[model samples]
Target chain A: MDKFLCGIDLGGTKINTVIITNKGEMVSSYTLPTLAHEGPEKVIQRMKETVYKVLEDAKLDVSDLEGIGVASPGPLDAKKGIVLNPPNLPGWIDITLAKILEDEFKIPVKLQNDANCAALAEYYFGAGNRTKNFVYITISTGIGGGAIIDGKLYDGANSNAAEFGHASINFDGEKCQCGSYGCFEMYASGTALANFAAKEIEKGRESVIKDIAKDGKITAKDVFEAYKMGDNLAKELIEREAFYLGVGIANIIMNYNPEVIALGGGVANGFDILYPIMIKTVEERCYKASFEGCKIVKAKLGQNSGAIGAAVLNIVFSKN
Target chain B: MDKFLCGIDLGGTKINTVIITNKGEMVSSYTLPTLAHEGPEKVIQRMKETVYKVLEDAKLDVSDLEGIGVASPGPLDAKKGIVLNPPNLPGWIDITLAKILEDEFKIPVKLQNDANCAALAEYYFGAGNRTKNFVYITISTGIGGGAIIDGKLYDGANSNAAEFGHASINFDGEKCQCGSYGCFEMYASGTALANFAAKEIEKGRESVIKDIAKDGKITAKDVFEAYKMGDNLAKELIEREAFYLGVGIANIIMNYNPEVIALGGGVANGFDILYPIMIKTVEERCYKASFEGCKIVKAKLGQNSGAIGAAVLNIVFSKN
Candidate 1:
């Protein structure tokens, strides 16, 4: 009888569950609405039911499972298995996720941060498979990252190593939501682009973005659309964002010297205008020796990366 | 017969060699003038002579040594064991130092960057001994650093991880020597402080630094001395330097989340005025979570760190 591994990616709005064999073959998978507004207990119950459904569809019993891995948003205490109060996931404070899952399924369980899970997945199956040291950066609503150094996850002193966006690119440029000054996310994240565009429109700069915005509010998608249509204001905003993004990438290269930097999340998903400029800026800024043979590429596993990476945790943890 | 290890630290002005037992007890040590003006071949010969002298003094034959390690300034290739053209050491491009020593003594020889060698020594015998994840920074004429992540030196994809000074603090602040804008070294290094003071004096700013300058050239020491005497110009200059240093430290914390940061090198040795302000700035700028339990302290290994760390390489390499 072949053993199976389970991985759960728990988010604010949804939960993704997958069961796979030790040989990297998928056995079963499913997703469910989190409905976190109903609170932690209900969410856990729904998650348990979804896991059971996945196991049943795969014709697997609970005892046949090797272990379970969970990837979730943090400020989490991975060692303690507690889900701390993440801004996006309300009422998840002090919840022992690994213990709850383990008790329900009678198997070992491990927990990891979502960005780290994506990096782990990429290291095993995506852009970083051929590289020993790499950084995975997600440039979505906010920038998040994970570093894989010397072929292992670099969980710092407290299991939180790569907070890339929080690193400052301009020490006095702007205030960040994290209560810091001039964070990389304030200049380069998807939300930063929208915010910049909104400010420009509000300042009465003439541009198509004013028309593209819905109800006097511009989204990152709307700004991207305006840039695609050759709006001057949008072009300047994106160019500035790409420039700062390049600075952040150069900083990462200088700091980690990773073999590859796999770019993911919405803003980095092959945004034609931003991608080339950002790459060029990184190459131009970082030390020549550090940049040599370092690759900056798009992430391959897409949305499935987090779930698959979380699931693979069982194999990594048990073996190491 | 007891086993022994050999370490060589090759610098522009001098060469240091030492022989030690497996237990890290120093058996013998010696230093020689490098006279690098005579070029790489002569420097290599001198290094060989120094190593033999140390061994002879210890009454050990070449066969008694486990391995040899050489630490030198880089842009070198650690894998190929070649010393590339480092700015400080002229005519050192592509010199295979390890192979030369290996051929001469018939022992395995390992090559490492000086900063990395110091980090390794500190990790095993100094400030970072208590923590698995730490960053070692040397701030003197310029800044350099290395990271130990997960109990091993993080050499990155190219054996050049943790170029901390090259990481930008303010992307548009100043043109740096590395062809980047606003690098940390440009703002916080000893050379940077001297250069900034020199420029300020040229701008006709009144200060005791102008009187302290030797032959109208302001040095960082002069600036520090003036600040100690309550010179307002020097005070403002030192404060700015400390603020930028703090920003750089905060950036390192956010990027690597190391358990501790050990600071060494000439400028950092006893810069009491800058230390408190720098630490405060780092605390003010970094996310509280990133700073939790993380320490910024003085490096304890002193000048022998490079040679000692290089010698210890045998133990680390053989075991891992």
Candidate 2:
């Protein structure tokens, strides 16, 4: 009999649930707004609803699942399956979501940080396939990453390995929210890109970015839109973004020396366009030998990476 | 009979060789000037002479040895036993020192980068003892490091893992020889400290450092001496050096999250003086959870780390 696995990607804005074959073939999936402002109870209730609906739509019972995995923003206790306080998911303090889900469904459950899950997803089914040393980086509102060393997730003391976002790129530069000066995320993330665009326009620089941002609140996506229209300011911002990403990636190469670095998330959606410039910067910053040994590519799983990796956690870790 | 292992630390200015029991008890040691300008052939001959002297002093023969381990500056091919163009040892391109030793001794030989060897030595007998996740950082004329992941040395894809010195701390800052801008070494190394002091003196800041360097060739040691004499310039330079180290170490914490970060090398001779400020900066930069989970300390082995680690390489890897 074929075993099915259930995965739940818990986010600040939504809950994503999926029931898939052990091989990652999606049988049924469901998504719903979290309405998290209503509190943990309401959000978890929605999460459970999606899980049950996904199972039902797949014509499967709770017993059919190998196990359930939950991927969420961390500082959480992976071993205890508790969600620690995450900046994105405000007020989500020490909630045992894994236990809550397990008790309700009467099935086993596991939990891990979303970055680690995404890394696992890529290693098993995406750009990291067949590579023993791998790293997955997500450049969304913030930068974060997970490393796979010798074919296993490198969960550093307290599951905090590969928090590359907080690593500073400028010792005397901008102060970051994390109490660091010029952190990688502060320079290269989508939020940083948008903030840079806004700061530039505020300086009276001419650009389509301001015109495109009708309500006057510019987004990183707006910069990309303007870039397509041949706006010089937009082009400059994107180029700098690529350069910053390269700088951070070069540091990552120094740290892990992985065989492959798979980039995912919001900014990485522009990966193909950014790759050449980004790689050129990397080549300039690192040893020819180290850079040549690695293959940098766009992450394949995209938005579903977290859910897919979450689903595989119990399957991979338990079997080991 | 106890199994005996031999280790050699090949460096730009010197060659250090050691004989140790499998349990890491030292039996004999020898050192020789490298005179690297004379090239690889002469350097290798001296290396062989040291090996013979160490064995003779220990009252052991080549037949009684387990295997030989050679630790050198990298860009070398460890698997192929070839020394590939290390900048410190000029003209050392593709020299098969390991094979030459093996052929002469009729015993197995192993090779690794010196930084990795130091990490392994620390892991086996120094500050990293009983720790699974460890990192050893050496801050000298330049900075370098090696990581132990899940109780084993992480060699990465091409023996270049943990080259943390090259990682940029400021994307728009001073250019480094490695082509990166504002590398950790460019700001925090012993050489960097001396250079900063020289620059400050050139700007006409009054200090005992000028008197200490009678030949007008400033050294990091002179700055430390000036610091003891309460030289204001030296004090400021030391503080900034500590600050730069803190910034780099903060990034290291983000990248590896090791339980222990044992700092070694020339700059680290003053680790106690630098530690408090460095840790304070790290505390200010990283999350409370991660900071609490790690223990930072001065490396225990000091200069002998590389040679000791080289001796244990074959023991650790082959036994596994």
Candidate 3:
């Protein structure tokens, strides 16, 4: 009998669960709305249901599973597998999802921050497999990052190592939610793009984004659409965001000299639109020799990266 | 018979050579004027003389030496042991110092950037021995840096991995010699401090630094002395420098999450004066959990760090 593992990508809006073979090929999968506002117990119940559904779909018994791995938004305690008030899932203070899953399934469980999971997936299956050192950055509702050094995840002293978003790009640029000024995320995240678009609309800068958002609630998608329609204001806004993103990414490159930099998350969907400009700015700014030929590539696995990464964690940990 | 190594720390003004056991116990040492203006051949001859003197003082023959390591300023090629147009050593372009030394003594020789050697010395004998990942920064006329990962030096794609000095702290703040703006070295180096002091003096700010530098050749040492005597302008200058330094260092910590940060070089001599303020700024700026318990320590071995690190390169390369 092939050993199997269950993986969960726990997001604020949804729960995605998968059953995979030891090689990390997904055998079956299930998805459900998180209904996180219903609180931790309800979310946990939904998560448990999804895991069982995935196993049943694969025609496997619970006894066939070797372990379960969870990837969640963090400010979490991975050692204890507790999610400590992740910003996206408000009121989720110290939810021990891993321990509860282990209890319900009678199997070992592992937990990691979602960004770290994405990095693991990229390391094993995406752009980073060719190098031992790299950084993975996900730009969406908020920016998140993870690092790989000498072929292992660098979790820092408290398992909070790769806070690349909080690396300040400007000392006095803008205020961040983390009570810092000029964080890279403050200027380059999807939220920042939306905010910039909304501010431009408020200033009566004529743009096609207004037509895309008839309700006047501008989003990053609206901005991208407007840019595609040749809206000068939207193009300028995206160019500014890409400039900051490029500078921030260049800073990471200069500091770490990673062999590759993997871009992931929702904003990466616009990678083709944004990457050329980002590369141009980085080339103009970063040290020439170190960054030359350093690959900047979009993440391959998309929505499944977190779940796949989580599944691989069991394999990685067992080998270690 | 015990195996021994030779180290040469070649500086613009001086040359220091030492003979030591493989265990790092110094057996004999000697120092002499570099006379770098005398050109490459004479400097190489002087370096050979210093090495011979140190060995003679220890009563050891060339046969006793396993190898030699030379540490010099770069843009040199470490792989081929060539010093390529280092700014301080004018006209010394593409000189293969390592090959020259090896030919004279019939022992293998290795070359490394001076800052990298200092980092290696710290890793082997100073604050860094306890951890495999760390960054060593030397704040002198110009800032220089090295990285230690997995208990070994990382030379990057072009042997320039640890250009910590060139990493941008502010993307648009000040112009740097490397054709970038707001590099960490532009704002935090000893050269930057002196430049700031001179600009302040030019603006007619009242400070004792002007009195100390009767010839108007202000230096970082003058700025420190004035601050020590409670000159308000000097205090403000130091504060600004510390803030930029903290920003840069915090960026490094956030990106690499190194276990320790070792400060070295001439400006590090005043670390006692700068420590409290530097730590305060770093704590306020960096991610709290990632930096907690991460040490900011003074580099041991002082002036000998480069030479000691150079000696160790023989062992490091041999193992590789």
The candidate that wins on lDDT is: 2
Interface RMSD of every candidate? 1.1, 0.7, 1.9
DockQ (Cα-based) per candidate?
0.79, 0.86, 0.55
For residues A1-320, could you state the per-residue lDDT of candidate 2 as single tens digits? Answer: 96898999988888888887877888999999977788889898899899889988998889999899999998888888999898878778999988998889898899998999999889988999959999999999999999999999887988789999999998888799988888999989999999999999999999999999969999889999999899999999999999999999999998888999999999998898788889999999998788999999999988888998899898788866
Kindly give the stretch of ten consecutive residues in candidate 1 chain B with the minimal lDDT sum. Answer: B264-273
Clashing pairs in 3: none
Range of the 10 consecutive residues with the lowest summed lDDT in candidate 3 chain A: A150-159
For residues A45-78, could you state the per-residue lDDT of candidate 1 as single tens digits? Answer: 9889878989999998888888888888888888
Off by over 4 Å in 2: none
Among the numbered candidates, top TM-score falls to 2
Q: Model 3, which residues run further than 4 Å from truth?
A: A21-24, A61-66, A95-97, B62-66, B76-85, B92-108, B317-320
Place model 1 in a CAPRI quality band.
medium
Per candidate, the number of residue pairs that clash is 0, 1, 0
What ranking of all candidate models by lDDT puts the best one first? Answer: 2, 1, 3
Tens digits of per-residue lDDT for model 3 on B1-320?
A: 76898999999989989887887889999999999899988999999999899989999998898899999987777988888788788779889888888889999999998999889888887878748777899999888888887677876655676677887777777777776678888889999999999998899888899998858899999999998899999999988887777887787777766889899988888888888778887887776666684789888889998999899888888986
Q: Which residue pairs in candidate 2 collide?
A: A169-B169
Q: Is candidate 2 or candidate 3 better by DockQ?
A: 2
Tens digit per residue, CA lDDT, model 3, A1-320 = 76897889999999998887876577999999999898888888999999989988999998988888999988888878888888778679988888899899998899998989889878887778747887899999888888777677766655576788888878766766776668888888998999988887888888889889858788888889888999999899888878878888887777667788999988888898998789987887776765684788888878887887787778777865
Worst ten in a row by lDDT for model 3 chain B: B154-163
